[model samples]
Every structure is written in C-alpha cells, then in structure tokens.
Target: MNHGTEFSRRDFIKISSLFLAGSAALSTLPSGIVSGLGSNPMNGKGEKIVYSFCEHCFWRCGVAVHVSDGRVTKITGSEYHPLSNGKLCPRGTGGTGLLYDPDRLAHPLIRERKGGKQYYRKATWDEAITAVAGGLYKIHEQHGPSAIAMLHHGFGVSFFKKMFSEIGVNKIAKPSYDLCCGPARQATVLTYGYPSDTPEGFDIMNSKYMLFFGTHFGENMHNTAVQEISEGIRRGAKIVVFDPRFSTLAGKAEHWLPIKPATDIAMMQALMNVLISENLYDKEFVEQHTVGFAELWEEVKEMTPEKAATITDISADSIRTVAREFAFHAPAAFVHTGRRTNWYGDAMQRIRAIQILNALVGNFKMPGGVVAFEKYPLPQPPPAHEHPAYEKEVHSKYPFFPKDEPSNTIASHEIVQQAITGEVKALFIYGVNLPETMTLGRQTALEALQKVDFSVAVDVLPAEVTGYVDVVLPECTYLERYDDLDNGRAFRTPFVALRQPAVAPMFESKPGNEIARMITDKWGIHGVFAPTVEAGLDKKLKLAGSSLEEIKKRGVLVMPATDLYRKPGEPLNLNTPSGKVELASAQLKAGGFDAVPKYTKHPEAPAGYYRMLTGRKPMLTFGRTANNRFLGDLATAQENEVWVNTTVASKHQLSHGEYVHLKNQAGIVSEFPIKVKVTQRIRTDAVYMVHGFGHNAKELKWAYKRGASHNQLISKTDIDPAMGAVGFQNNFVTFVKEI
Candidate 1:
C-alpha cells in the first residue's frame, strides 16, 4: 500500500502553482492543457500521452492527458473529439486538482457505533464491499427489489446500475433531472415527439438570431455550446435575453429585457400573439407541418403585448419589436429552450411556449435554427447476462414523466420522500452531494438520509452526505479509472468517446467497474459485468467494427456528420401523436393538463423578503468542483456572494461587500454568511447567489464554510404536476444582519 510518494503533496501544489502562473514548467504541454497554457508538447524521454474524456462537467469533452515519469502533468483537448474540437474549458484542465486532492476519499469506510454515537472507520475494500452488498441484499430480501433505489449523477454510475439490474432493482433517479434538464427534455418530447438532445438541438453557429428565456450560455460554460455561441457572435448573430438578472450572456444581448420573475409565461404568450396577430408567423409552414394552430392562437390572442407588459414589466413596444425582428430572421431564427427551466411550477408549459414560438417561425430542422443532432451509431454487444423480469418497476406519480430513459424511473425528490415514508429501504448515493443539492431542501435531504434503512455512498470526496451513510466506497478520479463508453450524447458529428485511465488509482481507491464486479460476486451472480472493464469495452467496440486499442489512440471514434437540415417538400415524419409539431399538445390535454401554454401568476414575495435566485459560476459545477482547490484558487471562485440590486441594498441600508446571513420565509437562516454584491445587474424584487457553497463537511477543508448555502435557504419548492420537475425559485429570503 505504500507507493512511497514519488510526488509529494507539496510538490504537487508547487507544480499546480507553476501551471497557474503560466510558467515554463508546463510550457511544453499542448494547447488548452494545464492552466490554459496553449503550447505543443515536444515529448522527450519518459513522456507519454493518454487520450480520454473529462468528467468535470456533463459536457464530457475529450482530453489528452500528458504523463511524465508516470504522473499526469497536464491535460489538453483532443482534436478528434467533436465536443472539444481541440479547445478545453478551465474546469477540464483542472483534473489534476481532483486527482491529487488531499481530501479525496482515500479508503473505504464503514460507519460504527462508538460511545453511543456514530463515526466512520477505515475498512479494506473486501470488508466494505461485503458489508454494502450484504446490507442491500438483506433489504431486497425483506422488502422486495422495489425497496431499493439509486440516485446517481456521473457516467461512472453505469457499472453500479448494471449490478443493480442483476437483483431486479431498477428504481434510479438523478438529481439533475428535477433540477436542471428535465423540463426542457420533457417539453421537447411533448411538442416534437422526441426528446431534446444536448446543445438543446440548436444550430447556434449558423443562427442569425437566438432568443434565450433565461439561459446563461457564457456563465454555464458548457464547452461546445459556448464555442458555438462565440462563433455565432463572430458571424453577427443577434441575441435576445429575458431575465431578472443581467447575466453574463445578457451583457452580450442585442436586448436584455429585465422580465419580472414568475411572469415568463405571460411574456412568451405575448410574443406568440404578436407573431399571430401581425401575420408575422410562417403561415404556410404552420398550415402544412403543425397541428393545433387554432387552439394556440385562441390561447394567445387575449394575452396581448400591452397586457404582458403590465405583468412582465417589459415595455409593449419592446415586445413587439423583438417579435417582429425574430420573424424577420425566418428559418434562421429560433427560440432557445433553456436548461434548468424548472422555475416556478409550470415549467413544462413554460418551455412549451418556447417550443411553440420556434415552431411558428418554421425553424425546426432548418440550418441556423433548430435541428436534432444524432448520436453515434455504435452497435451494442449482447447482454452480459439475462435476469428475471422485475416484480414491479417503480414509477413516477407525475403522468408525463419520461418513461423512455432506461436509467431513471422516478424523480429524485420522489425517492427522498419514499425513503422518509419507509417505502424505499435501501439507497445508493453515487457522485451526488445531497445536502447541497436543491432537490427539496437540505433539511429534507438530511431527513431522508437518516430515514433510509441502509445506504451506501460511492464517491471520490467525503461530502456531507457521506457522514450519514452506512458505507462509503472510495471511487478513483476519472483520470485514474475507466467508465463505460460515452455514446449517450447527441451531437453534429456522432462519436463514441473513451474514459481510459491516465494513471493508476492512488491509495485504496478502485474503479466503479471493479467495485460492481465485487458486489455481484458477493451475491453469487457472475458475468453481470465482463471479466474486465477493458474486455467489456473492447467487446462492445468490436461489435461496432472497432476496438478499445483503436479508440485509445484518439479518445473517440467519430461518425460522419449526419444531415441536420430537412429538404424542401420532405414529409415531416415526426414522432409526435399527430406526426407534426403540436402547437397545443394533445398528449398534454389528454393527461388533463393545459393543451396550450397558459399564463398563471405565481406567489409574490412577502413584505420585506426578496425572491432568491440561484445559478453556478463559470469555473465551478456545483459539488463536483466545490472542493477542487485548483479551480477555487481564483478570488471569484473562492465563495458565492449574494448579488442584491443597488436600489434594494440602499433601501435595506445594506452596504456593498458586507457579509450577511439570509433568513427564508420558513424562518431558516443561512448556515454561513455571504458577502453582499450591491449591483444594478439584478432586479429590486429579487436577489441572486451562486449555488453549491457553504459546505458543512469539515473534511472538505477548501470548500467548508466558504459561502452561504443556497440550498439550505430553499424552504419552498414548486413541483411541476405534468413532469414532476422540482422548482426552488419560489423560496424568498430577507437579509439577516447577524449570523
């Protein structure tokens, strides 16, 4: 176990510091490598390059890890990968920070009751795996397979998912579903008959006009999306942004309408009304390729720009101008269906309005507009083993929740509630830090964690959730492990990316594949996974006329770009119920929901409380990078500050750069104090703060108590009835002068 530290912790920090300084230490590395130093590496003796994909965020950009003397020195974007296209984001190049983090979960841990209190004791891999498997099996035997569920976030969880399928346990949920991508995905499915893919099915680079509801493209830092948006900007694309705060993307907009919070539906309806009333819509296309035009018109006709102006606080003239300009752009114009659209409770309908606007403009499948990208056509190998049919698959109570995604069966918040009610007995928390995750709230998440009969956490960091779990399995970082091949993402050029190890896993940490294999073996189930992770990957690749060895050279096997544009006179063979765009979804109406998007007024903030808004900083992706000190080195990334409107701050007698705590409507105070950012970038009615801070886990030394906990202040949640996506923007907060 003593792999005598060839690179001391101090040495690693020094190297990182040098990299950060843009010094000659990493000058020989490839462009987009460590610290954004773009240089071609001249590989000399004892140097090698390993091609792999990054796990910093879900974009999964391919990276070329440079190894010198058996240490990962730097990472650069792989030219062969479609997502990165030889450009890397800041977070992608900071993988070394995560791998070398001193606070990383170094060994498996088992909770022990000592002195009438619980604490974690380091255990061997065998002991930990056995305990976890035994406990979960006992729960399955006593309560049935339906009692077990998994809440996962990263690609590494695929191995554990396969292991659970062996025991007929299929209830899986991802917190990102309820929090980020669920609304956009489900709304697209209802309107277009197919789910929206990543990049949200937009042809950003070719677009002449882009309308964003509340999407913060520049700040979110989704690699490919940002790259394309930059290209669009260079090509003279006009942008329109409607948001309560003047976000990073808003600053680049041709028009930044400070639309009132919770009144987006009313504004969207007005846009639709303008297109219809002024005869600005694509009449021929709508008549030929869409249904429910009459229903849509009727719904929006009464919601005039003047009426919407009153509700949204944007001028009627501006709304009319944006609508006309949008129509002027024709098929090259499109309304973006924003990510994390789970704001308020009517997210499904809110996004439905965006889809309708795009449809009216006849932009579907058009260049410079909306187009559905294709995924790589990699052939799947035969199942490793067949299992018995599940007694009953857990289902979401929400009617329109996606049933096609094989991984998730219900909402993550539903799983939390189930655990609280004793319906779910066992849980596997994989790569998600539940306490900071805005599912229901930190208190509700803690309650669920405490109520679960048996819980196991597979993570790389000892996050707050780990302290409450029965077993903690140490997972190696992506740079030191292999996950399943990633062909899930759809893109312009379909490709399958690899996740090969750049270096051996440090300490006692093991890959998810190995951990899953051990658990299946303990259950007397063999061949659920291949003999080895490499063997399985090779087998699947071989079926697709490729090999693991071939993919390792480039980090990805790419397919030729598919035709994104539909030819004129082509039949609109859509997957919807009517085989056409549904301006008013019949599926929604049949489910007893609104057929057409409707404007519903949400609750107003109380007397002194302001609506609290949450978002992420560009350099961090919530919990994944919260403890990553390399990314945190920047002053801007160290902690989250509450951005209060200058007028509101003045009214409250609050000074800029002053620390203050926040108290929510339910009388819950923020765990830590946040610095005040008195700025004119936000509206007077609401305040904004970046999410994923105020870490309660003392083990996360770098992230602990860095800022206020946005999730902790979220005492109220609005769940969309149609899709079950959770919305936390309903929570309102007032400044607390004292901690």
Candidate 2:
C-alpha cells in the first residue's frame, strides 16, 4: 500500500515537498533519498495493487491498478464501486498508454527565443518555480490580480481555484458549466429550486420512456449511465433521440429524429404545445407545486406541431405522435437533460423548454423521473478564510445558473478578447487544452497567449497550449498522484473514495498539491492550502467519526442508502427565492429576461456554405487522447474523416475518401486536409467531425496533423445570453477539393 518516487536525471530529490511522505512508516526509508532514487526499485520483484479513480474523463470511474515491479501493468473497473460496476470503457482501459506516453514533459522547460526562432530548454525545478512567482507577481503589481485570468481544467481545478482566490484574483475562469453545461443547469434551476440535471439525478433505469436532444449518451459512454440505460432497455423502456447524425444511440432508439442542427428548441416547443392544448399535462401536480400555469399555456398556444415542422423539418405527425406517447407514459417518462448543450445562443431557452415539459408531467421527484442527487457530510480540511472568498456576482443578461456561478467564468470569447487587448496580462493555464477545445479559432488562442506578459502551462504531455507558453512545468500524471478525496457529489452514491498513487511519479514531475505548495510558497502565500491532500481527507473523515487510516485499508466507504426521490404528498423546500417550483421565474422577469421559453430563429449558413458542428467519440473524450498511442490504434484515429453529406458532396464533385479542404468564413483553412466520408447520415447544410483531432504540436508525435481541428474552422462565436457561454455551432464553412 506504500508509494515510492521515480526521480529523473537532474541529480536532485526532495520528498519533503511531496506531503505524501508524512507518516511514521516513512521512517523505515533510507536516510539518503537521492542515492536511493537513481537505482531504487520500490516494487522489488513483487506484485503491488492499488485502488484509484480514472483520470481519462470527468466521469472518474473507480478503478483497480496492478503494478508489477513499479510499472502499471493493468487497469480495470472496480466491482464494488457504483460508477464502474465492473465495466470499463475504451477510454478507461487505455489509461496506461497515457501514463507512459513518450511525449510526456520530461522536465521543467523554459520557452527560449533567440534571433528569430523559438525553442525550449530544460530548467531545474528551482529556476522554473522562481520564474513563475516573479512573473505573476510582476503582473499583479502593475495591473492588479484581476489582470491575471486562469482556465482551470481536469481534477486539479480545485487546487488552482483555491490558490487564485487566495491571491485575490477575481478572474479564475471556469469553462465547463459556463461553456459546456451552463444552459442546461440555468434552465433546470430556474424551473425547479435546484438543477434538474446531475450525473445521478435522473432515474433513467426506472423510466418507461426517455427523450434526448443533441447529446449522444451511448457514443459518449459514461460507464454508469450506459449501465443504467442497459437496465432500462431490459425493462422495456422506449427510447427516442433527435440528432443530425445517426449516432449509436440513434441506432438503438425506437425513434430517431434527424432534425436540422440548432433547431431542438422548435421541436420541443411544438411538443409542449400539444401537451397543453390536448389537456395531457398533470393538472393536479401543476396546482400543487408550481405557479403561472395559464400564462405558460397562453405563451405557447400558437407554436403548433406544423409550425415547428417547417423549422426543424421533423414531420408534424411524427412530432404529435411522440408528444402524445411521452405524455401517455405520465410521471414514468423523462426528458433527458443532455450534456454539451451550448451549441446555440438560445441554448438556455431550449433547455428550459425541455425541463418545463418534465414539470408539466409531474415527474420532478418521482422514482421514474428526475430526482435530486444526495450529498453526504464528509470530513474535510477547514476553509482558508472564515467567510466566502468571493462576493455575490453582479447581474448579467441571464443571471440564473448558479450550480457553480456562471458569472465567475470568463466567457470563451471574452477571455481571449480581453487578453488580446492587454487587459488580462497574465494567465496560468491548468490542464486546459484551450487551442483545441474553445472556439474563435486557434489563431485567437495563440494571439491571446502572446498578448499576456506572463503565461505558464502545467501538463503531462506537450499539448498545443505548451507551445504558446513562456514556461512549462511538468506535472505527474494522475496515476502517480493524490488528488482531492473523491466525494460522490456527481454520482448516485454518498461515499468517500481515495485516489492513491499506484506508481511513483515519473521523472521530475510532481503531483498537484506539491505543485500548488511550491508556487504558493514562492508567490508568498502558503496558508491557503492544507499541508497535504491526505490531511484534508483525514479532517473530513474525523468529522464523520471515521479516520483516514480506516478508509486507507478499505479504499472506499459507502454510506447507508437514502431516498433521493420525493415521496407522494411530501413537502419539500427549494433553493429558489420563493421556495417553489417556478413555472414562470420572477427573478428572470425582474432581470428583463423572458420568463417563458421562446423560440427564435438562429443564423443560417451562407448560400454556398455549410455549417460546422462537432461531437464526441466514445473511444476519445475531447481529443485530449491524441497523445495516447493506445487510442491512436483504436481504429477511428486512422480514419479521422470529416462527415460530409452525400448530397452536398455530389454538388462539388467530391467523392468518399478524397481529401477535402474546408475554408471557414474567417478565411482560416483547416490545418489538416481530412478524408471525406460522403454519407446520408448528416444534414446537407452542415458537415460534422469527431472533436479532439488535428493537434499541430510536433512534440505530440502521435496526434500531429492526423485529422482536422473543429476549433481551427471556427473563428467567430455567439455568447449565450444566460451565462456568456460560447455558441459553438455559429460558424459556417465552404469546401475546397484537395485534389
């Protein structure tokens, strides 16, 4: 159960910085640590196993790691944990390749530019940490802490969030909710007291019917949800999906509506209209739990199924049939709150429309409907400050989403725009691959990075972001680190799970806590963080009358099960101001936003242009797997083809498998010319591609120039009125045959 260290050729070793060495057991180690590191074999020809969590994606499935002689040999789903349930996806199984990626940052590197060329040189840990502290402090003095903005990604976000808050930096950019899930959360919270969408909230397993839009759950492959879907299907739950492509989930669904892109709102409005006019809504539940029933009906009376048919191109009869079927199932049916919902400017209204349908059916807290995710009072380290670190956020256009406040996030477009103007002078990017993920183009990202006086990137592999930074600090991969205790806030369970290092930190890399401490110490503020991640877990465990030593032996501690669903006739309280389910939000109306969901037309692609869109690959999550050799051999990597409609291809005399060049409105051509898959699966006016390909960093040997970057094709974005999230589908592109 003990972990060790794998030192690099720097001829330096320091276990004191890594707070994991705190214990009476470490007293048994050799007094001379550096002499031991050069030839140390902690495993000593014996087998070792450890329990940890997957770091491939945010799902964070519980995993078991088997280390043979200090090298990770295998990783599999833990049978005892709820998320994994003894099943692992392609991403989780391929984690070992990421841990041993040859492209990994071997040492601290300083971005050195001489004459006309830019290059990197190896730097010692001392030199790099001092540069970071000095550079950041310099910016703080000249422009105040707000001049430094950050984009926190991966599980290490909590560390940066706390550090930035302590430094009094007002702009610690959070992108996930605001840019990825903002609309869904805001719409859900505005309707109910809390968010209607959580990883554990919806009882998809017990449902009789389910509906989806945009999100492809089967293709995304969250182990727990995939397992739950299997259970639901076995019980005869009818599934329906609406997407531009015939995704894996669409193939499995009883009905797949190949609606036009960015038109999910129109279809949903038509469905709601039918339910209201036909008297299919739950009259009893509406009277008991909500307000503004009549006004809601009045607002949507004209949005008939036929009118929606013209907008979404889904037949009026098909729309009416699905609406009736959904309503017929009553409280046993669900409208799935989808992920990756920030596709259009009207995203919040669309999500609100979907959630409103659920409330109208009286399905909010039922066993077969959407339920609340329970949180357990676990042990933890005390806060750095007595009260909250940040003040109440100022009002925005759609000031409703507060799962993690949207106002706190620097908008995808806003961050770069501000950075280009020298308003944001320094940036400390943690785990975020901004060049690939965010829109407004790869050029925009580089320009923003260049505009900053100081920029530091912390990562394992040499990503596109690394080429844009002034300094790069190599961080230990999750396999060789201890992170915050895995509290099941996102899952259906109330438990505490540990993420222990199965293998020693490779090379000169350090874990998140150690990195945080080093920077904070040099930055002259060290009291903000607990001494170690384990210490924080111990404090949390002690509050619950448990100890870290007790959980360490077992690996996880699941609490007694409690009902997450509301029972019949149960009185409940809400986080909303009025403490009631708001069918019409007073807060929204007060803020001059539409209280009821409304459908507005989105901008169409130019006459000769095709709209650009993106989706996830089950084998890869957000294309961060580009550097993983195992994933590169997983079939899709070789074919990394752009999906063009057969009808559109014919007009341009293009054929399948031919390399096609895409030119966006901004005149930026894709970095890689992609093989075209001319098929009927996608819409005629739009082309699709799996995101996370076309990484241009030559250091990333496996992923460079492999496929195409969706980010490269998108030069402009529309911000969501609700949360300042980027509308990812706003860009348009035209084709050029790469003959």
Best by TM-score: 1
Query: In order, what lDDT does every prediction score?
Result: 0.86, 0.74
TM-score of each: 0.94, 0.91
lDDT string for model 1 (1-739, tens) is 1111210110101011111112332333333434432333556858889999999988899899988766777788888898999988888887876877767777788766544445567788899988988989888898899889999999998888889988888889999988788888999999998898776799999999999988988888999999999999999999999999999999999999999999998998999999999999999899999999999989899999999999999999999999999999979999998788898979988988999999999998998988999998888876767767453233335888888886677889989999888798788999989878989999888878877778888998878888777788988899999999999879889999999998898777899999999999999998788778899999999989999999999989999999999999888889999999999899989988899989999999999999998888888999999887668887889999999998889888899999999999999999899999999999999999999999988777789899999999987889999988999898999998975
Query: Cα lDDT of model 1 overall?
Result: 0.86
TM-score for candidate 2, residues paired by index: 0.91
Residues 1-739 of candidate 2: C-alpha lDDT, one tens digit per residue: 0000110001111211121212221332223221211113344576776878888887888887766766666677887666787788888877776776666776787655455455567789988888888878777887777678887677766776676666677576656655676677777778786654447468888999999887788778888899998899999999998888888888879899999887887788799899988989898888888887877878788889999899999999999999899989869898987877778777777877888889889888787787887666674656775424344232344365353652255554666677788777778888877777665667787777766677888888778787677778888888898887777364467677777788888768888788778888897776776667778768778888888788766467777766767768887577776677777777778777888878778888888888887787887876557767666676765436778888888898888988887888877888788889999988898888877888877767678888888888877777777656677687888887652
Q: Which pairs, if any, clash in model 1?
A: 31-38
- 538 Cα displacement, candidate 2 (Å): 2.1
lDDT of 2: 0.74
Clash number for every model? 1, 4
Show model 1 residue runs off by greater than 4 Å: 1-43, 388-396
